[model samples]
Target: MKTNTEVVTAAVVGLSGWDALVERYSRLVWSVPRSFRLSHTDAADVYQCTWLSLAEHLHRLRDPEALAAWLVRTATRQSINVLRLRGREVPPDRWEPESTLPTPEDVAIGSDRARRLWAALTTLNERCQRLLRIAAHSPELSYAQVADALGMKVGSVGSTRSRCLAALRVKLEASR
Candidate 1:
């Protein structure tokens, strides 16, 4: 399998590298909306839109090696846009129960703690949330990937992470 860097490099020169890029990052893109509890159809739309946006911007992307992060950031934004559009529609009062309950391991995380953590995450600016999410989920991403994704200087990821964590901690504690 081609590494992300090789796939993106091939894409830049008009090779068949886009297929590889899509295959490499499509699941990561889908996970964004899945995390948001978007319906399968809605999540698929976000996935398609993210890939289309990436296709349009690939030539101009600042760092080919950071393609994973770029796709992740794009997917996150597309999911948010999808949710906002959905929010504008009349929400149905009746809701169907989920087909499956969460796993025992998942349930072990107390609901109150999860709620507080989610609330704390929301207290962060969008960039911070994106940074933390990407960093947390994909530790393989280098500082360069993160910087390219979030439009920050490479030197600042650690400092920014520290500040964002402190902010989250403050919010979490204040909520208690």
Candidate 2:
């Protein structure tokens, strides 16, 4: 099997590599919405949208070797959009059963300690929140990929993560 780097490199060379690109990155693309705990239907929508986005911008990609990062970033954004749109929908009647699908927030903040951590997380600044969330959720992503996703300098990711973690610890302690 071709590695991700190889696949992306091939894909960038010509339209002939389109199928290889899709086959290679499909799992990575699908996992984003699933990690967000989007329903199967919603996840399918996100998966399709992410691939469509890649197809639309394939020829114009600034760094074709970074295709995985691009796909992940796109999927994450699409998942967030789905959640936002769902939020604006009319609330179900009291008799209706709650959605079986957990929200992204719920997926991240499952345990009691996690709930506390999440509360602390909410108190942090937007940058910290974003960085930590991306780091926490996308463990498979390299520092470069995370940096690309967040539009940060690659060297800054570790330092920023450390600082954000320190701030989170402070908040966690304060909440006690």
Candidate 3:
């Protein structure tokens, strides 16, 4: 059996790689909505949305090497849109706790905490706030996406996010 890398090279170069396509990327697709800490209702909706986005846009992806990253980006973008449509305020520059598919009560708790945290987040700077929120919301986000979003190298996303989260925590606790 051809491995994922082999298939990717085949796909990227525009050869026969359909079997490997499904095998390598199905899990990546499934993991999209799961990456968000969504409510059950929201998860299902997000899953459907992610698949629809993939269906609509997958063919436009020229770089087969970016298949997984593309799926994740689609899922995240769809999830964000769903949250916004639900009347939540989604900060364009940072992830919001209220963006998840949570019950009102859960949203209330998270929002209250996040409101305080956001205030602190602002103190740290926009970049720190963005990184910390992404880390908090999507533990599964790949370094490539993080790097793209933050304009950093893929390999550095994890360490940069960690430091940002630590700084946010300190600011949050100090505000309490």
Candidate 4:
């Protein structure tokens, strides 16, 4: 497998690595808008827009290795833009219901243990929730990318993650 840096370098030179870039970052990109609780359609738009943004600026990217961070930042901004646009709409009651069907991920995690873990996750503060979600959903992300995405110092990522996991453990233990 090509490293992210290699993929990015290839992309900068030609189109061959574009698919790899998209494949590598798609989940990380999708996770951002989902984290905002945007509707599916809105999330899809954010996802596309994020990729488009990357495509438009690919050659100019200062550090190709920071692609994950760039994607995260772009997706976050797009998600926020979507929320702001939705806020301007006059008819709040016309909102479509979110899908009731279980996503593949939902089915995969459908177990007593997973349910309990999710319940415990919900009890965490917003920062912890966001941090853990990003970390969990994109295990390939570097500490630098995670820190850039979260606007945290890179040095603090490991410590904060440890503390957050400890808190989650406490919550899980309490529930038992």
Residue 142, candidate 2: Cα error in Å is: 60
Residue pairs clashing, model 3: 39-101
lDDT of 1 by residue, 1-176 (tens): 77666787788777588877877777789888899899999999989999899888887888777877888888888889988998888666655457556867677767878899988998899988998898889989999999998899999998999899899999999999
Clashes of each: 0, 0, 1, 0
TM-score per prediction, in order, is: 0.49, 0.47, 0.37, 0.51
Task: Indicate the residue-level lDDT of 17 in model 4.
Answer: 90
Measured with C-alpha atoms, the lDDT of residue 17 in candidate 1 is: 89
lDDT per residue for candidate 4 within 67-118, as digits (tens), equals: 8999999999999999999898978577756786778887876776788999
In candidate 1, which residue pairs clash? none
Which lDDT value does model 4 have at 20? 86
Comparison by TM-score, 1 against 4, better one = 4
Q: After superposition, how far is residue 45 of candidate 3 from its true place, in Å?
A: 2.4
Per-residue lDDT value at 175 in model 2 = 82
Per-residue lDDT over 4-45 for candidate 3, one digit per residue giving the tens place of the 0 to 100 score: 556765655563665467566677766766676666687778
lDDT on C-alpha atoms for all candidate structures: 0.85, 0.87, 0.73, 0.91
Model 4: ten consecutive residues of lowest lDDT:
92-101
Displacement of the residue 122 alpha carbon in candidate 4, Å:
58
- In candidate 2, stretches whose alpha carbon ends up further than 4 angstroms from where it belongs are 1-16, 91-176
Candidate 3: lDDT of 20?
A: 61
